[model samples]
Target: MARYVEIDDVRVALAEPVEVPPRAFVGRDKELQLCRVAWGISSDGTELVDSSAPPLNFRLEGAPGLGKNEIVYEIARRLDMPLYIVQGHEEFTPEDLALLLTPDPEAVYGEVPPLTLRASPLATALYEGGLCFFDEINRVPDRALSPLASVLDGRQYIYSAMTGMNIGPRDSAARKRFRFCCALNPSLSNEGHVLPEYIEQRTLPVIEIDHPPFEDVHEIIRTSLSPSPDFLVAFTDWYYEQERQDISVRQAVALMNYAMNYEQHVGGQKTKIFDQVASFVVGRRS
Candidate 1:
């Protein structure tokens, strides 16, 4: 059944957790464990004290299309909590965080009903007490992101000026399980943001995701594209040969997808299609 809560007599639906299909999710066992630790999982499988170990709010910094989003999703999948995602953009605002609309009492002949607030993904994540992921966080303007300062720290509450109601710090059973993380994509961060220093200080121990090893990269590509063994070998060989190591797993997958399309539409040799995408698409990215 779908869960809900009452706030100021307004009924609000809680975010629900969705399951991901079990696929050959090629590597990152180490990072996965690290994320688990951040989210309050201990080596011996016991919940640590909050006073000594405050709740972990992670900041994932990496290039665009580097599987940062996937990493968090995997964390949520493991934790078995509702994953609420907020995509940061130039236009993101505090209003966007909590969308509130009052009932038009005059429009209706009967008595006015309670004012239910339409919560944003952030609010939903906070209210529901799950993993809240902010994708491309740096793209959100400072003014829009300022309200988050209260929620990231000891306060853990976002008071929506529009709604005149508190949105977070899940007081229910889910409070203990709530976690938050945000990703900063340097390549795609065209819109600048003055993210508060307080927020940075609050979300401790920043994690950096770099290029994966050859075997893991190949595995990632194989699972993503399912190319033939021969094609996989050639593609990996060519990929590693390049002096620049900027190509991420996501980029490699895109290149292969384009190669497959090229082979389908243009009717080239199977191997040559891979080569064309490498030279054109991958080369341009590099």
Candidate 2:
């Protein structure tokens, strides 16, 4: 059952505890342990005070599709913290971190001006001490990210050009208590943008996630396909070989599910299903 916590006297839902299927994640015991430790540091005030630690900020960096976001989702789940997601892109602006001009409910008449507004999504979430996930952090431009330096440092100061106001120190001490975590793609020649050095310096406890081992991959396939164990074993074995040749686990899962569904829809024959999967692996499908 979900639990509720009072934040600024407003109650928010804390998702119910659920069993984390071993298949969903494999290997990386050390990384999992580290995440758990960081979560404990953030959630338990007694532990934080004893260790003289502030909210643990983490930067999870890895190759694309390596389950970095999944780790963050799992951590949030285990900690029972409210999650707010922010997608970083070239168009993102400093206003994203500050206040946004949302529709005002207090506006009179059926017509409301777009100029009339409310707080930004991040600020609103932070006002309630919610966990904000900055997805693809490096994709956001350096100038756009400048405003977040203070916020990441646990200060909530934000300059709003729209209202010509600098609203923050929301409750003073607690204003500097929001937790920030981020995920970024590993810097590559093809990557779109680079994170500033200053922003890099502010991030702590950098964690890197690598692809799971072959056995773990097989387990993920099997567990995800538990309803059809026989087909799962065969499909996993076949995809395990494909993975050795550089196929992604995500593609493997997708192909397997597609093959199974195709078989069900057209005659329920294993031979036809295997052929469909093979075509997908070979990139022969139209």
Candidate 3:
């Protein structure tokens, strides 16, 4: 069900937060702590006492599939906050970041205006004091990101020219609780995908994320698929033998998952299935 909140004499329909997947999250202790500290969240999962200082907006810079999103999800889980996500792209506009106006389905005939104001995930998070994670933020162009400057800074509000409304938390408490984070592939920070200088300056404390260590990757695969020790041994050998470049956590998990599926449904011999899975994941060995 959609809920509405009145902001600046307009009824803004609140956007629901994306449901966090109930999956086993492993590793990234230091990166997770950096995010927590940026949000002013204590080690024990409580908000810090310094309400005077607003939380810093942080950015996760990494390659795609490196568990950047997972780190944010873990922080949200620990804080027990509603997480709203905005998937960045070239076409995202300023209005898309704040308010989206549409026709009202339930407006009475000649009684109320047909146009309805709908809040974006970012706006909803700002209003509700939740966490908003903008994924692949580098994909958004410079012109589309103008509104974020004020929101990222101490001003802490986004103004919508379409609705003529300033949308954000009205009180200090909600401002203290509101948090924003974004992730991007560092390789994309060139050509049309480069972040604006203002955005770069405001999204403080860039947290660089590389691929996890081999031990953590092993645990991640084990946790995701629960493969036998023999299967893992085979995987370890293959992993090093390839001397794979930029192998992400997602690819590692997918390798085991595809192997499991082959075992269950394809009725293949174990060794052959493992080889096929490896080829599918990392390309055939030269």
lDDT for position 60 in model 3: 96
Please give the clash total of every predicted structure, in order: 0, 1, 0
The top-ranked prediction according to lDDT is 3
Off by over 4 Å in 2: 1-28, 39-51, 105-116, 154-156, 167-169, 172-177, 187-192, 222-225, 243-245, 267-275, 278-286
Q: Write the per-residue lDDT of candidate 2 for residues 80-141, one digit (tens) a residue.
A: 55566777887888877766655444446777533434455455446655566788888888
Between candidates 1 and 2, which one is better according to lDDT? 1
TM-scores for every predicted model: 0.83, 0.75, 0.91
Query: Candidate 1 — worst ten consecutive residues by lDDT sum?
Result: 43-52
Model 1 lDDT on a 0 to 1 scale: 0.70
Q: Which pairs of residues clash in candidate 3, taking residues 3 or more apart in a chain or in different chains?
A: none
The 0-to-1 C-alpha lDDT of every candidate, in the order given, reads 0.70, 0.62, 0.84
Task: Report how far off residue 13 is in candidate 2 (Å).
Answer: 18
Which digits, one per residue and each the tens of the lDDT, describe model 3 over residues 1-286?
6789788777889889988877878888888888888878887655544656767899999988889998888777777789999999988898999899887756778776677888999989998888999999999978889999988987889989897889989576777778999999988885557888999998888999998999999999998789988678877876776676457888888887888777788767655566667777856646
Instruction: List candidate 3 stretches off by more than 4 Å.
Output: 46-51, 103-114, 267-272, 284-286
Q: What's model 2's lDDT at 159?
A: 65
Q: Number of the top candidate by TM-score?
A: 3
